[model samples]
Target: MTKRIAAGAPPGLHRALSIVEETAEGSKLWCAAAAVMACTGGRRGRAAAAAGLASVATAQLISNGVCKQLVKRRRPPKEWIPHDEVEDRPDSSSFPSGHTAAALAFTVAITPTWPLAGALCALPAAVVAVERVQSGAHYPSDVTAGAAIGLTGAWLTRHAPRLILRHWL
Candidate 1:
């Protein structure tokens, strides 16, 4: 699949994906979005932004700090990718894509609080997922695992406080 995408995708799409993927590094894009929401959006937007940022942070910790530490999977082979961007992939374990995890975490966390903004975020989240595989930074399974982690992170961010209070009280 990675090979097919690397070879078949047009130069224009490759450039676009590259830009998107680059912007996503270290969750920079999501952070920027959160800042925008917090600054320009009213009360609801601030709440949504807070939720989204929390989820992103949780997802990053789980995906990059914990999961990647436990898993030692290598990235897709360079030979499988046809682009120079493949060379720029990190040496860290590729069993889960941190970018995808962060992207989905933010999107999912914001949805219940702000549907319109969540819908807008969904596109870039999807792009980040695809770019993980298309850029040879991860296999599809890695992205899938990352997505699951992201959803779990969002769920935790949304309900953990209530759950903890319920358990303790």
Candidate 2:
């Protein structure tokens, strides 16, 4: 299934997606989002930045520490990928895409605080999710799992503080 998807991607998009896929590595994309939010600096901007940062961090930890460790899935076959993409691909477990997790988490978390920004942010998030599969780094299932984790993480980040305070009180 993954091989078919990889074989079908446009040659032009492969390079761009690989470049954008870098956002997944070290959570640089999320950092960029936060930086953009920081520059906007006001009540809404701060809230958006804080939520995006928190979502990305927590989703990354859960995906890398818990989900990947538990699944231990291998990446898609290198042969199925274009020559340029092999080196850029990840070596970690493949059941859940860390890149997609961070991308979606950032987008989902930002939506409530800044709906327009979040809507704009989703363009790249959607790209990275598909790119994870198209680049031969992850399967569709992996991207799906990562997205689920990201969405759940975003929800948790938004609501956890209230829940925590409620329990304490």
What RMSD, rounded to one decimal, does every model reach? 0.8, 1.3
Q: List the residue pairs that clash in candidate 2.
A: none
Q: Total clashes, candidate 1? A: 0
lDDT tens digits, residue span 60-110, model 1 = 999988999999998999999988888798999998999999999999999
- List ranges where model 1 is wrong by over 4 Å: none
Considering only N, C-alpha and C atoms within 3 Å, which residue pairs clash in candidate 1? none
Candidate 2 backbone overlaps, count: 0
Clashes of each: 0, 0
Weakest lDDT window of 10 consecutive positions for candidate 1: 1-10
Alpha carbon deviation, residue 17, candidate 2 (Å): 1.0
Query: TM-score winner among the candidates?
Result: 1
| Number of the top-ranking candidate, with lDDT as the measure | 1
